[model samples]
Target: MMRKTLTSVWPLFFGLGIIGVCIGAQGSLLGIRAELEGFDIRVTGLLMSAYYVGFLLGSLRAPKILQRVGHIRAFAALTALASITILVHSLIIDPWTWGLMRLLTGFAVSAIYVVAESWLNQAANNRSRGQLLSIYMVTMLAGLSSGQFLLKLADPASFELFTLISVLISLAAIPILITATPMPSFEAARPVSIKALYHLAPTGLIGSFLINTCYAMVLGMGAVYASKLGMQVDEISLFMAVLVVGGMLLQWPLGKLSDRMDRRSVICAAAFAALLFALVSGQTGFAADNRHLLLALLFGGCCFPLLALYLALTNDELTSDQAVGASSTLLLVGGIGATLGPFMISLTMERWGAPGFFWCLAAMSALMAGHAFYRRLIDPLPAAGEPSSFQMQAPSPVGSGLMKSPPSEN
Candidate 1:
């Protein structure tokens, strides 16, 4: 399955890998740059959070646009937009300008993801789809993590890194543009209402939102936090890289474990574990020692997998027919959480300084653990039904679209 899928679908994975790298580098660069540019934490939070706002909007709208222009043109146009945004950051460093640029960049990236995953769906069959997705998760993470190291190559304060970011975003378009890929048909997912989803799987819905809120803080504002703490460039790059790699390595093991038993147990356990790591990360002065980087790896390992776990838990409550819509609904819920995370966490950072970042993290983890524990006490999985099989992904609007696609026809 791996061999066949890779042979047929390498271009999509390759192109996406480059995009992942750009995304990783761009976020870290902006966060570090924002600090050096002397933007207040509140403004930085708003700037960073704007991406998720654009992301959520793009995810909702990308299907309609793709249906209008077709996949190739959509990918080309979106990539061009993303590339342009990278350069714009270098030219204009104002908080408001960057906030708007962040929104546009998020929109373009999210739309590209929607189109790219649709392209992959056209390439995969049932037997190979799972393998393809696992590979996809790894490819995206590897690129993302590796991009963090690119920080060492140039000064975050200079135009050079911005140029590199724009070049990579532009370069990612090549494999897709040159390949003769078919446009996969778009049947816009009718996401279940948020109210309905909450009632159906309260833990899943809430857990999805809360866990992703944590993820956004760790990813989007992590560099900013490191910068605030007086970390050098190499340390900041390592910090972000460790978090992504943790998510990459642990997602499958944690996800596959959930498939074997009650998923809420897994979610509860993971949440609690994250709470502990969050405590250690903040209270211990994570910046005080090099060894503390392990906290990020552990925190991310526990938090990232919950995205897939909550999706599975929600699906376990749903009929196969309802699963797809619910998945779309969860994406919206989580995306909103991600969107708010930076701003909310930034408020804490403003009050408490860098420690406020993980204090907010610890508080959220505790909340997640409490809620999951409450759900586990009140609601349990049925003995008669099996949980949905886990789908490992670097979940985004595009990745969510991949998960909601038709079950593989082997």
Candidate 2:
């Protein structure tokens, strides 16, 4: 059964993996290039933030586009747009122009995820869904990690890297466009009220918001921090790669552990551990050597799977019908957090220097830890059997499968 399911979805997995490579490399490449170009931290932060702005808008609008065009056509159109946008970055050097490209890139990427994930979900059944989701997550992480090492391929200061990114984005479209597989039907999810979502799962809602805020801080600013520390591009690549590797290696073990105990406890433990790692990486003078790399590994291990826990907790409180709405609401909150994270963290970095990046991360992780424990005290866990079965969640807000509404009953 597993083999058969895998066989069926191989194309989707392959396409998504390629997309991950493009995304991972493009982010680091742009950050490094922006620094080399002498763009200010504020402009860099805004450049990063613009992507999330476009992403949030794309998530809201992509479903309508999908409904009109169908998955394959939508995927092709978005991929082509993304490819063109990456090349545009190479032709232009201004922060404003790069920011505009990032915005379009984010929109295209978000819609691509919508097409990919919704197709995967349609291909899955109850028994195989969990396994497929795990495979999808691993594939994404592996692709992201591998892409980081591609930084060694060309200098960020040159146009070659941007061209490579465009090539990858273009390649991602080929598998889906050529596949004989039928397109999955997409139903647009109605927006849920934030007030109702808060009432349903306050802990999950707040944690999702704060966690993504931290994520955006790290992903958007980490490259800039490394560059400022005088690390070469290759070292920066390894740093980013190790962070993703840590997340990939640890997700399953941590996920399984959460299933056996109170998930909130696991969340608190992960948050606290992440906070400690961030502090060590940021504050200790000795950490400037290889010690910081190890710390980054530990940090990613603890930090990456947080959204899964948040989604699991949220799902536990929601009916299937409400699941779609709740996921959309939670993603919106997360998007808002991501949109603001880089700008706020950039201000800190400006005042406090590179260490400010990790300080900001530590502070956010501490907030998440503290809130998780407080919620545990006030709201008890559901009975062991009562919680929804755990499933691996994609890292991005846009790809949560619950974004698709269920078919209507006659």
Candidate 3:
């Protein structure tokens, strides 16, 4: 059964994986290059935030575009644009121009993800959907981790690296365009009211917001932090790679643990663990040695899974019919947090130093831990039958449109 399912979804996974490689490399490359070019940390933060701004816009608007052109054409167009956008970064040297490029890149990538995920979802039945999503998530994180090593291929100071990223983006278009798979019909998700979402599951709502904020900060500024700490480019890549690998490794165990008990307990415990790692990574002399990589591994393990936990908790409160709208609302909240996170964390780093990166992470995790404990005390868990099984969430908001009724236990 799993073999047949994997056969059917191979094209989607292949296309998404290539895109992930480009995304991972491009993110670290841009941050490092921005610092090399002497862009102020605050400006660098804005440049990073620009991606989320465009991503938020794309999440809202991409569906209409997908509806008009259909998935294949939309994917082709977006991938082409993404390729062009990366090359544009090499041509222009200004922060504002790079910010604009990042925005366009973000929009293109988000739309591409929506198209790919919609196709994957259409191909999946209820029996295989959960398994399919797990595979997709793993492929994504693996691609991301692999891409970081690509940084060693060329110096950030050169145009060759940018060209390589563009080449990868262009290649990502091929698997989808040449595949025998038929395009799926696109459906617009009804927007859920934020007020209603909050009322249904305040912890999930707020947790999604805060958790993604920390996520964006770490992803956007991590390279910059490492560069500022005097780590060489190779070491920086390894640092980012280790962090992603740790996240991928822990997803299943952490997810299964949450499924057995109150998810809020898991959420609080994870956040507290993240806080501890962040503090250790920030306050100690580990930042300069191999010990920092170990801390990053532990930090990623604790922090990366919170978003999935929160999403499961949110789905617990909503009826099946509300899942689609609720998913969009949760994604919007997350996008908002992501949009603001880079700037805030960047400001902190600018005022303090490299350790400020982990400091900001610690502060956010602390808030999440505190809120989870308070919510557990004040709010009651839903009945066993009410909660959705823990579903693996993609890093992008692409899967929201395909959200369905929770499956019954076997």
Candidate 4:
């Protein structure tokens, strides 16, 4: 059964892997490049935040696009736009132009995730759903993590890295565009309002926003922070790769543990873990000691899965009918947080220097852990039925298979 599932989805997965590679490389590439160009830290923050702003916009608009053009055409168009935009970053050196392109890239990438996840969800049966989603997460992590190594392939100052990213994005289209599989049908669900979502699952809603804020800080500014600490490109790539792998390693175990007990407990533990790591990182001077790899792993493991945990926490309180719509709400909330995190962190960094990065992380972690414990005390209600099962998340509205799985014919 697993073999047959792989056969059916190989083309899609292969293409998605390429997309993962592009995404992983592009953010760090731009951040490193910005540092090399001597762009102001706050300006770089604005540039990075623009992507999340565009992402929020695209996530809202993408369902309509997928509905109109269908998946194949929508995917093709978005990838082509993203491909062109990434290469343009190399041609133009201005922060404003890069900001524009970064926004476009975010817009295109978010929609592409909608396409990829929506298509995968439609392809699964009950038995295959878990297997497929598991494979999907692994493929994404492996691809994205491996792509970090591509940093070692060329100088950050040269156009070569950007070109490599462009080439990967372009090649991703080939497998997807050529697939003979039937296109998935799509319908945009009416999203629950933030007020409604908060009322329903305060912990989940607030957690999503807070955790993603920290996440975006790291994603947008991590390379920049590392560069500021005087690390070389090769060391930066390895450190970055360690962060990705750390998240992958912990997501499943924590998810399984969440399914068995109060997820908020796991959520609290994870958040506290982050706080501890952040404290340690800050004290250690944010890579002052030689344990750059260890600090990166501990940091990634503690922080990366919080959004997914919050997604499940929200959905645990939702009826199946509402789960689909809430996916958009949670993603939008996270995106908004992501949009603001970098600029805020950049200000902190400017004020305190490199250690400011970990300080911001520690504060966010404290808030998340404190809130989760507080909410659990105030509202202890569980889902009316079994809680929604946790999955390793992909940060897309649909593709992460966060919605209750479609009823199985089998």
All candidates: CA RMSD (Å):
2.4, 2.3, 3.2, 2.6
Backbone collisions counted per model = 1, 0, 0, 1
Per-residue lDDT of model 1, residues 1-410, tens digit only: 66765776677888889999999999999999999989988999999899999998888888788778877888899999999998999998899889999999999988888876766776777787666766777888898899999999999989999999899888888987887545676667777899998888888889888877887787789999998878899999999999888887889899988888878787779888988988788876655657668888998888777888877778878877777788778878888998999999999999998889888988998888888788778766442467777877674535454334533221
lDDT of 3 at 61: 81
lDDT of 4 by residue, 267-330 (tens): 9999999899888887775355567679779988988877778888888888878887777788
Q: By lDDT, who's the top model here? A: 3
1-410 per-residue lDDT for model 2 (tens digits): 88877787788888889888888888889889999999999999999999888888888889899778777778888999999999999998988899999999889988888877787777777888777877888888888788888789988999998998898888877877887766677787776799998988888899989988877777787788889888899999988888878877787787778777788899999999999999998875224568989999999989888888888888877888888888889889999999999898999999999899888889999999999999888877553336776666555647564456234111
Q: Which ranges in model 4 have alpha carbons more than 4 Å from their true place?
A: 286-289, 380-384, 395-410
- Candidate 2 TM-score to native: 0.96
Worst 10 residues of 2 by lDDT: 401-410
Tens-digit lDDT track of model 3 for 109-224 = 88877777777677788898888878888888888888888899998999999999899888878877887767777777787899988888899999999988987898888899
Would you list the C-alpha lDDT of every candidate in the order shown?
0.83, 0.83, 0.84, 0.83
The clash tally of candidate 2 reads: 0
**What TM-score fits each model?**
0.95, 0.96, 0.96, 0.95
Candidate 1 Cα outliers beyond 4 Å, as residue runs: 286-289, 395-399, 402-410
Candidate scoring better on lDDT of 2 and 3: 3
| Model 3 TM | 0.96
Our model 2 lands, by Cα RMSD against the true structure, at: 2.3
For residue 49, what is the lDDT in candidate 3?
93
Error of 3 at 125 (Å): 0.3
